[model samples]
Target: MKKLIINADDFGYSAGVNYGIIEAHKEGVLTSTTMMANMPGFEQALNLHEQYPDLGIGIHLALTTGKPVLSNLKTIIDVDGNFRNQAYYKGSFIIDEQEIYDEWKAQIEKILATGIKPTHVDTHHHANLFGDFNAIYLKLADEYHLPVRNNFTNTDSNRRTTDGFIYTMETVIQSSETLEKVFEEYNSVELMCHPAFIDKFLLNHSSYTYPRTEELELLTHPRIKTLFSNHKTIELTTFESI
Candidate 1:
């Protein structure tokens, strides 16, 4: 049976994002989300998490788009304190390995401090996938003993989702037939999605804004529900499940 992990990212970026992620998990087929420890709406996200205990939570190991959880991170952050990365900003940047490690540790420790055990672990802008950061991240995951989303394993050299079968909102909205083909072809797949209500923060901080709403609508559609209806046929799962 194929296992599909539908994970919504950026749970604590803002109030609007928190609302969308919570709404998706509670009412839609969304089974999991990755929480940002250093984001603006982190507290609100944690509070909502208490309400939906079934939604699998994971640490969104952040090194981008905001200030570091640890103070005085000179190497990783710019003069303004924003990490050299943004939500939609994707490229290579020089990193101080030690500083980034400490920052991620702080991020994960912040989550554990709340007594909310994460279901798994992932990253922001996939910062962990580059340079010596991958080694640092994997070491942290092992140390924390948390299952990582897509670690060093590589079946496809592209995206880091399960077997590299990550799908986009454009594909989902434009053609369900394409998705069906994908669903039939893969035994395991991790579909990453971002759903949010855009505010000034998202608009200014991310190159991706309005499309987030579109993603939210597509994932919550009733027709999409029918696809994962039979448990015996396909396992709708999270990293915590298996």
Candidate 2:
């Protein structure tokens, strides 16, 4: 049978986003979410985990766009501690993968130590696919025996662009096909997404935030319900449940 996993990303970016995700779980088809270990409202996510015991939570594995959990070196992060404003940057031929991996492990350890078992793992901004970082993520998933959303999605011709960020965004936009294909190709697969409202605040803070809201709209659409009507989908069996 075809299975579906409706995952919401950015569980701990802000209280507003956290509230939106929880409400989505209650009122929509959100079965899973990824938490940002280094975000401001992460504590709020932890509190929500305590209250909503059935919500399947996993690490978002953030290495871009937010503050870093580690303070050792400014390789993966800027001098201000926030991740470099861009995705996948290299400084003078140095990709900083080692620092990134070290911080990634630390973040994972911190999440596990929270007493909240992670149901699966995925990256915050698709940083897991950068250089050798993908192998590091896969190794961690294998070590924990947890699944991860490998976004091996195909890109349409219209998605091809000279701009890196826009091209990547379009790749993700065209990912439902990739997600479904992978679900059939592998057992117990995972897919990641960001869902939010296109409010003025989100619009002002981030350009991709609106696209994330668009994802939310699609995930909660009635057409998706019909598409999955013939299949049996699970709620991801949260770590909290076990």
Candidate 3:
């Protein structure tokens, strides 16, 4: 059977983002989301999860955004003490693998401490795929026995992931024809999206803004709901189920 998992990332970024994610899952085809442990809205995301028990949750691990959960990291942090930005990951700056592992472990543990069973693991800005971070990413997944978002570059025979991963937000959100093609092409796929109702925090912090509202509209549309629900071969699935 063809399975599709529509996962909204950055679940704990802000109240606007948290509300938008809940709306998408409740009113649209979204089946899962990943939370950022160190984000401002982390507590709100957990409370929202209590209200929507069936919305599968996962961890969106970070090395690029916000402050690290663990203190005194010599390698990953910038001079100002916040974690390095996305540009740092894209460049050739050296990172300590042990720091990556420890910080991520703390992130996972923080989520687990809240008594929420996370459904999977992924990275913010797909940062875990850079350099030796992929190995640590898979290692944590193995240690915790959680599934992961397939970036198509990192592979582990024992890891649990969908058959394919699809991105390119602008094209998918604007064109239902393109979304339909995605379902037709893969037996199982994870489509990553960031849907939000813009607020001051989101506006001030994130560069990829306005398009989120477009994604929210597309996701919650009745036609999009039918496209996923009534499709003959496509099954809406969650990482926990897969």
Candidate of highest lDDT: 3
Q: Give the TM-score of candidate 1.
A: 0.87
Q: For each candidate, give its TM-score against the true structure.
A: 0.87, 0.73, 0.94
Error of 1 at 48 (Å): 0.4
**For candidate 2, what's the RMSD?**
7.4
For 115-179, candidate 2 gives per-residue lDDT tens digits of 97887787866777665577777767777766566453424323211111111222322445644
lDDT of 1 by residue, 71-122 (tens): 8688888888877755323465565689988999999999999999888888
Candidate 1: worst-modelled 10 consecutive residues by lDDT: 156-165
Which residue pairs does candidate 3 place in steric collision?
none
lDDT of 3: 0.87
Candidate rank order under TM-score: 3, 1, 2
Tens digit of lDDT per residue, candidate 3, span 1-242?
A: 77778899999999999999999999987889999999999999999999999999999998888899998799899888899888877768787889999999999999999999999999999987788788898889999999999995644566789878988754653454776677666677888999999999999888989999989998899877776665666677899877
The lDDT for every candidate, in the order shown, is 0.78, 0.64, 0.87
Error of 3 at 78 (Å): 1.6
